[model samples]
Target: MTAGEDISVRRKKLRYRAWHRGTREMDLVLGPFADAHVESYDHAALDRLEALMSEEDPPLLKWVMGQETPPDNVDLAFLELVIADHHARLAK
Candidate 1:
């Protein structure tokens, strides 16, 4: 989150960004993930989610979809959560 930003504001912004990514496919992936889980996320998790969303759409989408492994610098733990969330969503 940016300097002086309230945590609630940060979460709202993250949700908006997730749902409004330029690509519709990305919107579908990240939007629901943020909606389902962002309320329970702590500051560190929010930081990780923001980091994950910072990645470019194509590479990020590939990673989330398991089409490619994320690099070491990526937030692996959070990515795992998102992947699990995504699959759980699919199962439903």
Candidate 2:
């Protein structure tokens, strides 16, 4: 969090970033995921979401879409949750 930036503001910014990831595919996947989860996120969860958002669109999209494995440095557990959430949404 930035100096004096409220948690709610941070979450709102995260949601905006998730929905505007410079790729339509990323936007579609992450936007809804953020909508469903971001509000309830604690600081650590928000940081994880921010970290995922920091990646470049191409590789991030591939990872999220299950077309490529994310790097060892990436957060696999969180990524799995994202993938699972996306799949769950698709099944709905």
Candidate 3:
């Protein structure tokens, strides 16, 4: 994206990517989360999420589903936030 690009455009792009992930499981996991939070996220959070999105779907599914933990080198705080939010929605 152009340096002139700002949050709104970046957010829209994020939402689009989340919804269009090649796997249906990924789309379901990420699309709603992005819709709910991307617009409100700080640049640093967005940067983290964007980096996360570059990862393959299988590992993300494992992490989000709690079948496997995120790696030690990865950031956990934000991932926990997302996983907790996802689980909360499921509980509702």
Candidate 4:
């Protein structure tokens, strides 16, 4: 499938599962990360994440959920944290 098609399919699946609505601010910070490297596993998500990361330093989860920017290097790490948290929540 084309990139557009792939994005559409993935977006639909994510939305359907309510995956994008992350239960916490940290989850929100990590949602893009998991979406990039884990769940839907799209490289484009990673690219977008990389771009986001490059913009600023790490912010609090609250800030992230509030749409505050994060530093470039921390984006992946941030997402990893969120993904792990998400899994832990699921396991509970």
Count clashes in each candidate, considering only residues at least 3 apart in sequence or on different chains.
0, 0, 0, 5
For model 1, the superposed segments whose C-alpha errors exceed 4 Å read 1-5
CA displacement after TM-score superposition, residue 38 of candidate 4 (Å): 3.5
- Candidate 4 ranges with C-alpha deviation above 4 Å: 1-39, 58-62, 65-92
Which of 1 and 3 is the better model by TM-score?
A: 1
Error of 1 at 22 (Å): 1.0
Candidate 2: segments with Cα more than 4 A from true spot: 1-5
lDDT by residue for model 4 over 1-92, one digit each (tens)?
99878776665554333333435544344554445554454666645544443332335453444455444555565555554665565566
lDDT for model 1 comes to 0.90
Clashing pairs in 3: none
Report the C-alpha lDDT of model 2 over 22-85, residue by residue, as the tens digit.
9898898899999999988999998998888888999988998878989998989888888899
lDDT of each: 0.90, 0.89, 0.85, 0.50
Mind sharing the TM-score for model 4?
0.27
Winning candidate number (TM-score):
2
Checking candidate 2 for backbone clashes, the offending pairs are none
The residue-level lDDT of candidate 4 at 12 comes to 56
TM-score-superior candidate, 2 or 4: 2
RMSD of 1: 2.7
| lDDT measured at residue 20 in model 1 versus the true structure, 0 to 100 | 99
List clashing residue pairs in candidate 1.
none
* Model 2 score (lDDT): 0.89
Candidate closer to the true structure by lDDT (higher is better), 1 or 4: 1
Superposed Cα deviation of residue 58, candidate 4 (Å): 5.2
The candidate, 2 or 4, that scores higher on lDDT is: 2
